[model samples]
Target: MRAAIANYWWGSSTDNRHIHWMRWGRLTAAKCQGGMGFRNLRHFNVAMLGKQGWRLMSRPESLCARVLKGRYFHDSDFMECTRKKHASHTWRAILAGREVLGQGLIKRIIGDGSLTNIWRDRWLPQHFNGRPITPLADQYVTRVADLITASGQWNEDLVRQVFFLVDAEAILRTPIRGRGDDIWAWELEKHGMYSVRSAYRLLENQRLH
Candidate 1:
């Protein structure tokens, strides 16, 4: 398909040899950057797969998710699931998409901090990697729940003690509502809906930079 598109765009000369002017990579750049906003097939494919992966993660109760979970990831969630030795092509594709999701997904903590790990999860918004930069200060306080009081309030003193000054400030700034469950949200989308365009743009930007 890519070859055909390139052929069409850079048609053959009189000698039947293609007269390419610009490279395909440059042509795939966004129009604002001076190139046509053509989709880079590989990134676009992964972005599309990322949308499918998002659907699976968001709609765990769906038949497709249920079936795939039962077969490939019954013991773990989609984002953390691994590729088995004999995994099908579809599963591999979804996992590839999940990688893209991992790049931009973050847990939206709603006061109930049981779902996130204090150090492992990307819940810290201010940090560059969305995680606390401080080394673990205490051995026992491993989960975000440990930093929350019984009344659904942050244990300010405990948090400050558990992290460095910067991380403590970032954690204290995170507003925690009394919502029932913490949820994963897409950082690239305002409404948290995963779309191919957003994922594609993210991939493109990452590649360029």
Candidate 2:
């Protein structure tokens, strides 16, 4: 479709020999990079679908997420769900965008930390290796709440024993609010909000790495 649009825009016709000017790659370059700032169709489609994936991740209790989860990922994380051969087109599209969403998102623990599993949940900052703080983290603490004392402060001694000194220090630094539900955030964004634009940028950046 984009090819057809470009052909029409440049007056390329079957009856006449076509003359090429600028390349499509340059036309699709961002405005700041000195191009036309035209949206890349493939990226735009994935970004639009990724918006739906973000909705599923952020609004797990919403009707759409509930229905989709029941149908697709009832026993697994949405990020871990695989595409089924008989799935609907919408489901497939959403799954495609989920790859982008997963790369740039992280979990944020708040208040009681009751909802997070220390070894299983991604409450810590993502490391370059993308693994938990310690290989034997599950052997140390079962849940994030376990790291908290009865008085609601982090268990510094226990943390230092279970994690590396560096990781233990980082864990101690995570703030605990008096009361609030745990939330997830887009690690790449400053405001902790998910946006298709930010997600799309993440996908482009990932390609370089």
Candidate 3:
């Protein structure tokens, strides 16, 4: 991830003389494209958490956010809150985990359909025409599928709700073809009704809510 960010910021030199300039977007292409495929850690971190923001915004009535607010935040931003005077190793580990996971490859899919459908659709095998789920992609695919199944609804209103919750204005702007598709897909795919339901169920199971 550091290498990728460095490459994006500073162009690689070729043959110890020539300089090869690569734009941030182009440099971020998958490894198969001859790029390192490292995601910008900060950007990916924000993107990953954007789903949570979307959830809280979309479901203000949800008990999870309310509990979180009362526990550590007290109506303050999560990033700004510092209730822990000394950050524990667990907290540092969590932050490190976020950095590592966020920098890894992200596979995003988008379609003008329900979030469940978009998430459940699969990629086909090389030898077959029809889509066949593979174990390798199952982790990511299942994560999305489970999220949609847990989150109940996916509609424009939910999008707006999340947008306001995150205090992000870009969601209101016209969507860009590729970039916007990924961001929008990430939000809708992860924060649907299924996700909330699953979280609520977990909280109930743990007696945390």
Candidate 4:
């Protein structure tokens, strides 16, 4: 299953450059694009799992957060947490995840040993913008600050309003069709509801009445 998923993600091309290009494009369209229209399962998995990381970074008081602080971080920010000179693969992976959160993008090459130049250029501004907070935006700003701190990037507190502002702008600029369509359609066919939200509401109504 894992090998199949990896093959689907990386494509069957033996040439390294072609494989890289296909991975970069994520997936191809069928008939019109002259290829099978397949989704990159690895990318999809990362995107979905990234939400859980967001939730974890959002809720600092959660048990998982507490455990992480006690075990790996020891209450230090992610960047401050240190292991042996040569860390294990698991440690390296965790650090990589933290680096991604710190960078806010996955464009940088991994295993480079040094932070990329683009990181310095992009991160500083984002960090500075996160600093100032108004009365109404304090909670969201604090959350962004926590994420920043945990990621060991910048100290600025990005206001939730501003974050959402950029988010809305991006959504408007680059439209996405069939977002979550596979998951929703699968659920609807199997369980008669398109989402957990509708299913939960139905159960709640039955319990109450």
Candidate lDDT scores, in order, read: 0.84, 0.76, 0.37, 0.37
The C-alpha stretches of model 2 lying farther than 4 A from their native spots are 8-17, 31-35, 125-133
For model 3, what is the error of residue 64's alpha carbon versus the real structure, in angstroms, after optimal superposition?
2.2
Per-residue lDDT of candidate 1, residues 1-209 (tens digit): 77777778888645687777888888898899989877899999999999888888788899999999999999988878889999999989888887678888888787578888877778877477889888765468777888888888889998887788998899988878677778788877788788788888889889999
Displacement of the residue 36 alpha carbon in candidate 2, Å: 4.0
Clash count for candidate 2 is: 0
The regions of model 4 sitting more than 4 angstroms off are 2-37, 79-94, 105-209
Candidate 3 deviant stretches above 4 angstroms: 1-26, 29-38, 75-209
What tens-digit string does per-residue lDDT give for candidate 4 at 1-209? Answer: 54455565556544442243443232433335554545434433433443344444455689976776666777564444776576656555555443324323211121221232221222222233222323333343222223233333432344233444553233123212221211111111233222333333333333335
Candidate 2 RMSD computed on C-alpha atoms after optimal superposition onto the true structure: 3.0
Clashing pairs in 4: 130-156, 130-157, 130-158, 131-157
Q: How do the residues 1-209 of candidate 3 rate in per-residue lDDT, one tens digit apiece?
A: 66545644564444343344765555645577676565544455444444464454346568976766565567654334554656655444333323222222122333322331222232211212212223343233232222222233233453443333332232223222231222222211243232333332232233222
* Tens-digit lDDT string for candidate 2 (1-209): 78786787689878864665878777777777776766677877887887888899889999999999999999887877888789999899999987667666666767677877676556666554223567772484777888889888898989888888767877887777666777777776788777778777766555435
Better model by lDDT: candidate 2 vs candidate 4: 2
Q: Compare the candidates by TM-score and give the number of the best one.
A: 1
TM-score of 1: 0.92
Query: Alpha carbon lDDT of residue 72, candidate 4?
Result: 71
Pitting candidate 2 against candidate 3, the one with the higher TM-score is: 2
